[model samples]
Target: MPMDSVMGRARALWEGLAQVPVSFAPPGGVDVVVSPRSGLCPDGWVGVVALGGSAIVTAPSDGIAVLVRDALRRLPVEAVTDGALVRQVLPVARVLGPAALSYVSPAGFRAVEAGASSVERLSAAHPDMRRLERSAGYEDAGEAALDEITSPAFVVREHDRVIAAAGYRAWPGRTAHISVLTAPEARGRGLARVTGSLAVAHALAVGMLPQWRARRPDSLRVAAALGFEEMGFQLSVEVEGLSPDFSDAG
Candidate 1:
């Protein structure tokens, strides 16, 4: 029921963001928190003011709009719902539980510190990274660009090709978190494990904490194996559609 409502909100948000840029470019925007929805929205959702794509409901706010705000709070990326009735409305997506916001300190963040990295370091990206990309559904964090302002990125390569990657993003007082994804065609090759470990371990070494998502069972395992402790849990709520307002012109 919650998923259904979030699905509807997602559709609505997508419609709102239809003309806006949700995903940030390497050199784009100031930070992840731009104020189209306002407050706490940036920490969870990864897109711009226009709401599109999938979302997670982290908390059950007093109002339904809070679902959208909560979805933007997830570290593991999810669609947490407040109740079953929420889902009854959307009917397109479902509640995928919540993600634990597990983190490792920079002292223990040692995944990438292990060996020679085949991952290329680029400021902006070339078309090659897209080829290395497996799924078009999820977006990627440009480590090369993030490195310019945040943490560095390392990846695995095959046949001189960069196939997988992992890196971190900073949030003011903290050096913050990391993300890793493998090319779908290149699954089961230990690339995610390797990249994940390196990314978290390095974060620990730098006095920064390594916080990744424990959304799926495998996510918990991979992050835990790298010394990331389970910080707790994060809830997500997705809205398939909502009546997004856009009448202001200030």
Candidate 2:
């Protein structure tokens, strides 16, 4: 996708995370989106842009009809209510678990600078990796994913122990998705935010947009504090079991 298109997609994703009603008019048509804070599809709603495409929506039956109509512009559109909307729309879409999408522009990110006296670049060989592996707030897969990262990774330490770490995985176009983990005992100390800021700074320095996805409210709060705008929430469900992806009554 073109850079503008890529940015637009990122913006839409962030708007979804914000869980607010939105109307986006792109080239050919407009997308009427909504992210209901509660009830069905608690994650969010995304409308299909094509004339005969499918949209993944999470709303009451009545609201679904209005959103679908506005989004498809009277075109034949399929409304899928399942949480696994990504997998339904794009078979190749990876299951990323429950997450909220957020993003920060370079200019906006300048306001969230953090200072970490002992932050250091991380590598597979870093001894702190062992501590991160054992931390309850982190997962082995997250540590392993570090190997595939094309952007920067950092860790904050207190003496000899790792307190928090932040990193990003390269994504399509000029965006990089960020991930951060803080030791359970290190919570509320701002280690995650400080380390995360370092990672964001490095990403912006390299001309990459920073994208934040998190399922936890605390994580989302930190992202918001760092100038990341909430776009939407992402939820996934099993694809093998379901009926026709439409419901007028919800």
Candidate 3:
């Protein structure tokens, strides 16, 4: 697909996910809206997404939305997505991320040639997947969000155990949101890249735009190695008086 077309689809995906009517069109700035139906987050939460210098802010209630809009309306997309700036604006907010948003097109992807024969495709809900997540502990597993994926999991095993895994969940506008996890002891073995490569390839095969939302440096490196282009950033905040229920995050 052409670059413009790919980006158009990406914009549509995020707009749909916002749940409140919004757009990524030009005049590059933020659009703050209050919506109880926001797919970006649940009620009492705040989601800020910036793409190509344009942004959208979704808040759970009118008061919260008004507060955020008054504070961030004058800032550029880059600053709106900045954790420090956001914290300064809302002094008592708990920020979840300023995750780097990346996208891979068929023309931009660089697939890895894997020689690891232990890699196998399995269901994302397989018992072994649970074992792998447990081995990695709750924090890492949750960061990777592997359990939340809907696609087939591409996993690498060592000594009859799943050491690394990758997959993508179907998102709006036919986009694939990639997720990857590796066992604690299996770091630096390139297993993540191999499994991630497989996952990206599969998403591209089905003509879905692949998106990588990375919070860690290592995850960003993997996305870059696979030729995913960093396009923007996303930040989710829990305001001072509004408690965000994270039960749905998993």
Candidate 4:
């Protein structure tokens, strides 16, 4: 299938701009491709898509792509893009499936809308750090926000407690993946959008493209408010359970 037909417009834009290679699988063998391009694996992951007797695989290196190609052989074609099955096979991988939505901001674009005036940049030493740690959204985020607190994090304070927050998980290359959190009691208050705007502004200021991934409609709404355009869904498989290090594979 054409890359545009399979990956959608937004993905094609950046992927084309990055000049990443696109390959079609041959019969009885894996497509086996590796690219360091940030757009292909924005979250530092590898992705494989198997459908209709063809497979498309992307990895940081040829060795990993080969490993994923081999693994894909043991699975049904449907499993190639199945985030759940891929995760089971590669427990260390992060998988994104059709259920996930990917969004990206245009170059030279900054959030023009204003966020909450009460927003404050946060750090590990912030007094509300302890409370933020206990929030449902933070826990659901895999506690990445805690590690990223030293990075560009913004939050909204309510009575000396942080009620919502947003920050970047990692800045790999020129792409920065953003994560947002809002306390359960603070939901529906637009705090996420407010703090998220601050995070996006910070990313743009530093010359990094902001990326947003949302698994729910509510989160998508927040991204839309920040002027993020939906690109496509991403499915990735972790390299866990395999040899801890596959970097040197020949």
Q: Provide the overall lDDT of each model, using Cα atoms, as 2-decimal numbers.
A: 0.44, 0.56, 0.85, 0.61
Using lDDT as the measure, what is the rank order of every candidate, best first?
Answer: 3, 4, 2, 1
Off by over 4 Å in 1: 1-39, 42-97, 106-120, 124-126, 134-149, 238-250
Per-residue lDDT of 39 in model 4: 50
**Against the true structure, whose lDDT is highest?**
3
Tens-digit per-residue lDDT, 59-122, candidate 4: 7666676667666667765456667666665555445554344444444233634344487677
> For all the candidates, what are their Cα RMSDs to the real structure?
12.3, 9.9, 4.3, 7.1
Residues 73-185, candidate 2: write the lDDT tens digits: 54323322223433444322223445656777876774444554577887744657656657743463363354456655688777688777777887765677787777787
How do all models score by TM-score? 0.52, 0.59, 0.92, 0.60
- Minimal lDDT window, size 10, model 4: 1-10
Q: Tens digits of per-residue lDDT for model 3 on 163-199?
A: 9999999988899999999999999988889999999
Looking at model 2, the pairs that clash are: 14-230, 14-231, 15-231, 16-231, 16-232, 17-231, 17-232, 18-230, 18-231
Q: Which of the two, 1 or 3, has more TM-score?
A: 3
Candidate 3: TM-score? Answer: 0.92
lDDT of 1 by residue, 1-250 (tens): 1333332433333333323333321221111222334322332222222112233222112233344333334322223222343344333243433445555544444453435545554331445555555342334333222333255556777777766666666643343556666666666666777876766555556655445654567657777767666533333333343323322222
Please estimate how well model 3 matches the true structure, expressed as its whole-model Cα lDDT: 0.85
Q: Runs in model 4 with CA error above 4 Å?
A: 1-31, 34-46, 49-103, 106-117, 124-127, 143-146, 238-250
